[model samples]
Target: MVTLGLVFAGPCLVAQQAMGAGTDEVLQAQLTQIAAQHHGKVAMFAEQLNTGKTVGLDPDKPVQTASVIKLTILFEAMEQVRAGKAHWDEPIVLKPGDAVSGSGVLMFMDAPMTLTLKDALTLMVILSDNTATNLMIDRFGVDAVNQRIAWMGLKDTHLYKKIMKPATEPMPADQPKFGLGKTTPREMAKVMERIGRCELAAPGEPALPGDAAICSVALHMLRNQFYRDTIPRYLETLDSTEEGSGIASKTGSLNAVRNDVAIVAGKSGPMILSIFTYDNQDHSWTVDNEGEVTIARLAKAIVERWSPAGIDGKTLVPGLGLAPVAGGGIGASK
Candidate 1:
């Protein structure tokens, strides 16, 4: 790993070397500007697959992942299938008891219904569906998910059970608290890299019955994510004529946080990026609209800045960074 000097200093200086030479100054400047503009702690990580190079701002700082942690749930579910503890095609009943009050279309359904484990997983990842996630988590067992997190060697990531309903207020001591997921930008990127490399399967582990076929199935499910419907809409300003170098991405948000992570097909190879912003004050449903637009804009700007023609190797400092002007629109209210 190459070390980069910080052109601008402060708390952002921690882990500065993780970004490599010449890039640290650029990232520090970007983070300083973002922190000033948004009045929030913003951490980001981007890795170039072709070169094994990474650039980040507060890369290891732990923050709320919001719905982005669903990706972990998605991966763990796939791993369970690989271990023969569950089946992708197994039927799961959508009873009222399974409902969770947060994001997703599944929460609006009236009658109890049935869906395959595979379809539920799709809805969970593609739509960031909370109801689907809760049902799956209940079935898979929250303890199992945490076990997988430990098994995967993620230090600052974990699920604190599952949130079933929107909080009217903080809960009492004995009542079940609404458990949300938390992680740092760097840890999230590691999980994405693992998925891209098809390394979700534990090594030296025997393939359980019916598990061998799951690898392709898991890949297919990820490839067919429903969020694709919103990417073009969000990234409309991007030069789409450059065919075949598309991106696979997921966006997550809460009241004050906005985030997006993607694996971009670059000219040299795939590039992975995870950008997270927290404590954003632009919460208006009308002024800021959906936070997704802002998040997408950030993503586009990072890609443009980091790519060959984007920054010209010059560092982006305070008052000197590119901003994403447009992209896919934000999702409707959760």
Candidate 2:
């Protein structure tokens, strides 16, 4: 593994060297080279779900989340349902004053509209809808969300405030530094892993009878996510809308940053890729944005190296049918 210097702000974290069967010196070298060539700083972590083989670059460095933080909100919603704090069909009102600017059609919709909690969550994940996200934040307090994140054992991950709105409560000293939220590549990847594996309970707690059902709902929404310009750019072969892509992902973008976190069900096994690029020179929102392309390149390289036989879309639904590891039980694939 190569040791590269951080050219951007914040403490430098050494890139995590590849481990287990996924530990290909050539692959790690390629990843380093790709990161070095990019116009911005890059941080990523990828894990093969079945074997626990992993690879990463600056995986522990915290960075701006942009819309990627929505994943946390979605996770909290799932937990709420599991605890009977909320229900999927619960009615959620969207007042005219509630709508905020930036990504999503809900803001453009008529004022005082009523939608189900499931509808709001679907919009939040599939569209990266800022309005839907804010609605969720309002429904689920910011403090509650952070508590959920802490419960996950993530130290650096945090959701600071709602999209396009001011933080009502006092914020951390560095809240302005990381816009909507912040999280390390590894932490965000862990969140994705939990959803993929359907381990909804807190550590050591047994999963509820409906945990798999809730996870299926979340995974289905992610599988239908509309933004595929980043990680799925090159690796996807089918129309995700018509025939679901083997990948379940969420993307976040800013003028100078691009992020994507995904669970790819490959022929080899299920893998998680959490990638972030920041302080980029190319800020274009086009499909060819340098940061976007950089993420795509990185994902393509990792997926190809890890799953040479390619991915299978059929494995993504019904709890990812994830193969059991040493202690975890097997989930038969649909």
Can you give the TM-score per candidate against the true fold? 0.73, 0.91
- lDDT (CA) for every model shown? 0.60, 0.85
Question: What is the alpha-carbon RMSD of candidate 1 to the true structure?
Answer: 8.8
Over 4 Å off in model 1, which ranges? 1-17, 21-36, 165-179, 203-216, 219-245, 286-294, 305-334
| Candidate 2 per-residue lDDT over residues 1-334, each given as its tens digit | 3344434233222354435455555666788778877877888988887776677787888999999999999999999999999999999999978998888999899989999999999999999999999999999989999999999999999999888787788889999899899999999998998899887887778878999889888887888788888988888887666566688899999999999999998889888999999988898889999999999999999889889988875557545674422211012232
Worst 10 residues of 1 by lDDT: 311-320
- List the pairs of residues colliding in candidate 1: 233-328, 234-327, 234-328, 235-328
Tens digit per residue, CA lDDT, model 1, 172-279: 342332137777788888877666655655777644554434544543444334543222234333433222114555667767677767665444445677878776
For candidate 2, the lDDT comes to 0.85
